[model samples]
Target: MSQVFEGYERQYCELSAILTKKCNSATILDGEQKKQKLSEIKAGLDDAEALIRKMDLEARSLPPNVKATLLAKLREYKSDLNNLKTEVKRITSGNVNQAARDELLESGMADANMVSADQRQRLMMSTERLNRSSDRIRDSRKTMLETEDLGVSILQDLHQQRQSLLHAHDTLHGVDDNISRSKKILTTMSRRMSRNKWIIGTIIVVLVLAILLVLYFKLAH
Candidate 1:
């Protein structure tokens, strides 16, 4: 149960981050920015879907009541993501348009719609779905907190695991950095050594020539 909850927690955090990133990315009016955000949202959705499957499996193993609650939460999350997808589709398709473009806009049907009625209805739907999903996720989290045994021992164990993972990651990063620095240093040293060798060879050749010249002069005299 704890393991399943852990996975769900990670998924929830990822989804939240993706939502925040999408919102931030959407702030940029550029098409590139929008595309990037869209891609991120897709990836996030994929991760969420995978997590949902895992949760489903774990839920099957849980007590009937817990399983039912989790299943309900999962369904709500699925619905929410679906809604968001629809809204996003509408946005990409440019379903929203000027009032002059459609009579529905003047009739208030379009006005009631998100952003613009001319904008793809899919996109608007997606937005609504995401909002609902977020809400449900929050509710689910609260329920889990209240129902689950989130004692100090469990929390401390999780903290230790997190710390270990973080430390490992940092250590790997440090090693990579060290290796990069070492390579740079080695390259510099190799270049310097080559220069030094060239200089020494040149000096030796000059000395040899000088000695030969002196011998020749002495022999000639």
Candidate 2:
């Protein structure tokens, strides 16, 4: 991967640190200040998400041999990012609930019907906000599930390839054993042919000597 991809990991860490600090101190800040800090946290989270996506793409572009390990690490970072986002959402939701409570408490002997209408409006707005946040969470969850499925499929392919390699290795070993057996059989046949040649030569020499003795006897007579 390029250095830009590597730098993204570090950048995410820095952004996460800043967001964590902001979240920790958010409760102590005044309402306006808390809203501003939440805005910054949301921006930082967006940057973190961008960095995560870049890292994932870079890791996936690596060769398969090394890609698995890098992808595992990337998944861990993604999980961390999910946790951070969840925390930020929780803080934002808590603020909404707190504001609703403060508004209810401050209404002080106001006209009952008007108070009811105002509270209902605020409740409707909060509900809409929650629904929007839920939709985003659902989308994120769906993407994560798809990524996990892809990883599982890759692992299965690698396993099948490993099984094929092992089967091929066994077949080559069997062929080598067959070759060795054929070599031994040919060696034994070659030795038997050599013995038969030596026996034939001995018989011919003996016959020639016998004929020579018979000729000598005829000449003497």
Residue-level lDDT of model 1, residues 53-157, one tens digit each, is 776788678767556655665665566556556645754564555542345434433343433333335434543565466568669878888766667668989
Q: Write down the lDDT of every candidate, Cα atoms only.
A: 0.64, 0.71
In model 2, pairs of residues that clash are none
Q: Write the per-residue lDDT of candidate 2 for residues 55-157, one digit (tens) a residue.
A: 8888688766345545655675676678668767866776546564455346521333353345445534543564465567668879999999999999999
| Lowest summed lDDT window (length 10), candidate 1 | 110-119
